[model samples]
Target chain A: MIREFSLNDLVFLLEALRWTVLLALVAAVGGGLLGLLVAILRTLAFRPANWLALSYINLVQGTPLLGQLFVFFFGLPLLGVNVDAWVAASISLSIYASAFLGEIWRGSLQSVSSRQWEAGASLGLTYMQRLTHVILPQAIRISIAPTVGFLVQLVKNTSLAALIGFVELTRASQIITAATFAPLTVYGIAAVLYFVVCFSLSQLSQRLERKYHAPR
Target chain B: MPLVDLADVHKSFGAVPVLKGISLTLEKGEIVAVIGRSGSGKSTMLRCINGLELVQSGRIVVDGIELTAPGADLNALRARAGMVFQSYNLFPHLSVERNVMLALKLVRKMSTEDARSLAHAMVAKVGLADKLSAFPDELSGGQQQRVAIARSLAMQPTLMLFDEITSALDPELVGEVLRVLESVAEEGMTMMLVTHEMNFARNVADRVIFMHEGRIHEDGPARETLSAPRTDELKSFLSAVLH
Candidate 1:
């Protein structure tokens, strides 16, 4: 006997959305801050810092997100530092976001023409001054569309957090499907919910892309 | 001591040698023009003096500071030596006012009011006061180059290096930029320039240097050099451009 999805199921999934939004925010704020550091280290002329940032980006991008999730959620327990699914998901997602965004930002930062650096340097501006006055301003303009695009990916990626028993949108949908035997109704709604969030963000990125490209 | 003295300077880009044992000197307030065909190391010599390019061997002294020394203060050196490029490398993101005001506020640490006023004065000097709020893209190639000149002049540098500053301008636009350079010259600014405008050199430069195959083939008073051809290399060079 299969039960139709009651309002309770819809309500529960709506509640899980808070976790989804919270996780994405945590990743964005944490990842954004650390990602700036990673981007700087990778782009700077200093060798050792560049190597360290390169390794960080490789380590994150080379392996599966699931592997990193377990390393934080499951593997960390063996070391006797207990962490909940929320903490582990936040940590894993933040690290994941940092590596990806750092590479994106590094590309933007490097995209500022070498001639721009020479112009700034020729004017007797120090490296830091050159970056703030000229390079970073141009780089930030180049970075906006991609950075916002990554945020949309990040929102969708939060669904993977449910695998670790975090009870986000996917997990909540799974629980409803199991109990009601209405995978069609429950999953359809879940899909709509995810689409709504991701689509809104994707549209925002496109709008911003157009806005940035529009002439002054 | 000369304001700038380069002694047997040699420079390379990876495997290709550009400036090979080049030597030159500029006294205070001398307006000298360097001329040569492409790949003759004229521009590289200017860059080395500004510390924009490093030499593999030999020495470059700008304003009594040896740029060859490892820890030489580049900013302090650059502060005294302003350079204008053929490409007019103005900060595209900044307005004309901000572009001229950048080094003043950041490097020299001038107050906002002081920087703004000085920037206005420099822009007016270049006859671009009406376009002070304009972006680089909003202006013509000639106007942009004038802004570049004003940006450099705002620092009140003791010496200015022009790397074919008029080469990128349209044929009609060339005169406007050259006129700005003329006023700058009239102000008694010490300047070293690489230019293809033979007439500009004839009219404005006190001295002329003709570089050939990484060496200065001919150098003398601008009046005499433009009129008489001592070397076949220079004679051919002038013949190629003059027509």
Candidate 2:
């Protein structure tokens, strides 16, 4: 159509960014809950539970994100589940985020000194009490940096949703580029929007880290 | 009944046996100093008494709780027996008062108000009353060790175990921590301590247990045991330590 690269196109891209933000939020919350379970299982001394968590982590981390998205988008129809692009993208991104977040959190939890456990035990704290009151508070501090880093990665990874015809930021950019014949302008603006999100996340993480680790 | 009873206690880490068939009894209000060379099972014996380490064979009964029984409630036993370590292991994230009060609130289920007052008193007892609001890293090693003692004391335990508590302190800082232990002894608290402080053993402890190669080489009145030894190992150990 060779339309003008106008304000309406910019508005459309901005609107598409809203979907990207929402998808990232859904993935984060879903992944966070599932990742907590994974981390606890991996850190526990029970062999069966540890093995189960390890295998799940390996399965998610070993496969490609695109393959997972494809499985959910295409494979679900074969199973008669009939999920749309939204469901498929959300599920696959969440699972992908869970494996990385789980491993990062498990490392943080275990990094706490063993002596701290003994100290808590000798003071008569129950296992759950020790975990909640002592271990988790310390581990939260250790986990902040890597966890935020993964979130930033997750935000950028939302672009992959466009491949499955989901109308997120990248897909919106492509639509605008085809109409206006302005690929450079459309993708450049899209890249800048991603930078804004990731940079703000990093800043927010630094503030949280400072707040938690500050001396009493 | 003895406050603590360890009968034919044996423990091993993987292939290496640490304590070999050790039998001991501690009467109420008795302060026993366990002295030995490194790797002599002194610390392990203290640890086993508090259920920190499991003994492969034999029995440990602390405050009438049978620790060797299957599914023993170790938390209950530990409530009656407090332990202090060489590194002080204070929850660094908490202030001195909170560190002392955490178990009181969580384990003892005391109200926050009650825990606060008890925390104050325990910190005062250790001569760290002024440092209540300070964090662990802000204090000197000796100060941190005193705070550790206060933290344990706040639990109102019947017996306390000290695992080389002053061994990690600077030479000058050792005196302050030992002084806290002396006052604790004066208050008639039953305590078992693994220590390298020979002089404190002679002066403060009611009994001395010298361990050699995972066995008790000598056990007797502290002054008597320090002055005159019964075994060649004890004589040599005393000479080597005293020198």
Task: Give stretches of model 2 more than 4 Å off.
Answer: A214-216
Point to the candidate with the largest DockQ.
Answer: 1
Q: Which regions of candidate 1 are displaced past 4 Å?
A: A199-216
Residue B100 shift from truth in candidate 2, angstroms: 0.8
Interface RMSD of each: 1.4, 1.6
Score candidate 2 by DockQ.
0.69
TM-score of chain A of each: 0.92, 0.97
lDDT of 2 at B151: 92
User: What's candidate 1's i-RMS value?
Assistant: 1.4
lDDT of 1 at B206: 100
True-structure lDDT of candidate 2: 0.94
What is candidate 1's lDDT per residue for A23-129, written digit by digit as tens? 99999999999998999899788999999999999999899888899899999999999999999999999999999999999998888888888889888899899
